[model samples]
Target: MTQSMATRATVTVAAELTDRCDRCGAAGKVKIGLAGGGELTFCGHHANRFADGIGTAAERVVVESGFGWKGAQPI
Candidate 1:
């Protein structure tokens, strides 16, 4: 993955994602665009579980409004 892609992310707030978690079949609270390519949606539990990695690996992240995703930076 390119450093530019990994570092450049469009962060947004959301209520729910378009689909379920990529890692697990649960409601998605955070949606992430990958640095390599593609996207991932994770439940609140998983989002917190992979916070540190997500912060570095995601190209973009959409977090629920008013909901804190450890990997997300406020916009």
Candidate 2:
């Protein structure tokens, strides 16, 4: 795969605690992987507020909405 696709493939749910919001510095509940090899974390409110921008720039978006649901697994 290309470098960009490789970066996108690397996006994974943080196994530890949640990250800090990039906007308000609150506890982050959402994580977005950018088109390149960068990521942005945000709380629920900020994620909602910046949904459009995130949707536009993000190659992958993962939100931890308190369900504690981990990501997919190998079959």
Best-fitting candidate, scored by lDDT: 1
lDDT of 1 by residue, 17-56 (tens): 6679888898888989898888888888999888767878
Worst 10-residue lDDT window for candidate 1 reads 1-10
Candidate 2, position 35, lDDT: 80
Give the whole-model CA lDDT for all candidates, comma-separated: 0.77, 0.61
Name the lDDT of candidate 2: 0.61
| Model 2 per-residue lDDT tens digits across residues 1-75 | 221111222334554436899889988877888888798987767876665566567787776645232222111
- Residue 6 shift from truth in candidate 1, angstroms: 12
Clashes of each: 1, 0
Candidate 1 stretches greater than 4 Å from native: 1-8, 73-75
RMSD of each: 5.6, 8.2
